[model samples]
Target: MIKESTASAFLFHVDGDGVCRTALVWHPRLEEWLPAGGHIEADEGAAEAAVREVREETGFDAELLPGPSLALPAGFPHTAPVAPWWVVEMDACADNHTREPHRHIDHVFVARVHERGADEGAVHEVRWFTEQEASEAEGLAEDSRLQLKALFAMISDGSLTVAA
Candidate 1:
């Protein structure tokens, strides 16, 4: 199956109630709630695509949390982009008569929203889900639920900071 590159952002923010929440959208095709993301365009890298998708889908400007950086020697010839928290390849479509089967190589990143904005370009209804709510949300993929749980655990343990 052909594989398409994609970038996904797990955008988190503190709500007025002082609870950390992540944005999710109801995907009609997949019939599940998922992170805001889409295919990486030909002109952009995964990190860039992640940020762009978040803004387009949620109308929020988000900054991706920096991943662990390598200690390169001074003045290295290469520039490193922000790394993703995780990467996985999953089936995008299967056993469909109209569409061919394909897999998506998804680069996942954790980000913090700078401020709230209008949900103008959102293609689907958006909702903010608390960690607990995400974990127990119906119609959520199992992998997504696991990711949410891990994100929440990291935040609680101070391992992953969502502050701007």
Candidate 2:
């Protein structure tokens, strides 16, 4: 039996000038809009992959919000451990391209960017949507919808602030 492949992904919600919106990409296979994320590559950690995936999909550099970390002992390499803010267990079936059905154990993260734009790495068109717009958007993935709610909550609580 094949085990679910581990993946890392993140969504960026930027708030500048009283506007709140999230970055989304069009999924050609699914024929719908989805968040910026993808499979984790070999030789990459979850957190690293999350950051890399977002940059590749959305063309914006992302940094995970800092969290409590263990203190390194004496003589340690002095590297801080980065952990994912959330983990989602989801199954992604075969699309138009891939025939085999499989599941992805997704390591999810959220980030803030000064601006939203596309770059050469963008395979599909990237768009930003407000919380209400995203929630009402047609053809959005169910998982993505749920995650958006949480992101808006963070924004409401002021834990995640959009800088000018």
Candidate 3:
């Protein structure tokens, strides 16, 4: 099992089409390319934390798609996972603070955004970049890139469902 303090990720895809676009947050810590998510906090579920984190960090209010939280099983590296993950996303960032202060049992959720925004909450900025662009971004992990690739495939194949 992954440690509780590990940071989880949640990439929100907005208006995904030919390019398979997504919203990338410039995290101050890693100083690298990453999604709008972090550790899960106390007094909340992982799904709720993901939605709240995306909104607080990206100025986009996301809706966490319902289902079992996507937990990486023991010893299964990111590349070998065959099934798609729990996807969630939004383009409207709700007003909130972005200081993520918690340790957690990491659970990454993949989501597609419903709308595009030029500006929003505490998030310094927002942009629609293709999944390919994200995959090639500096400092991103191969596993993360593969995960995004899988997410795009699911989005393209109509296996992903978005709930308002």
Report, for every candidate in turn, its global Cα lDDT versus the true structure.
0.85, 0.70, 0.56
Candidate 2 lDDT over 75-158, as tens digits, reads: 987576476666767767874334677667777776667656545577667788888988899988877888788878877898
Q: Rank the candidates by lDDT, best first.
A: 1, 2, 3
Per-model RMSD to reference: 2.4, 3.1, 9.8
Q: Which regions of candidate 1 deviate over 4 angstroms? A: 94-98
Q: Per-residue lDDT tens digits of candidate 1, residues 1-164?
A: 78888999898988666789899878878889989889899999999999999888777778998666666689899988889988999987753432687888999998998675567777677888988889888998789899999889999999998866
lDDT string, candidate 3, 10-84, tens digits: 555445343457776765554555667754577666666677777777777665553444666889866432221
Runs with alpha carbons beyond 4 Å of true place in candidate 2: 4-8, 13-15, 67-80, 95-99, 117-120, 162-164
Pairs of colliding residues, candidate 1 = none
State the number of backbone clashes in model 2: 0
- By lDDT, the best candidate is 1
Residue 93 of model 1 has an lDDT of 79
Superposition error at 21 for model 1 (Å): 0.5
TM-score, every prediction: 0.90, 0.80, 0.64
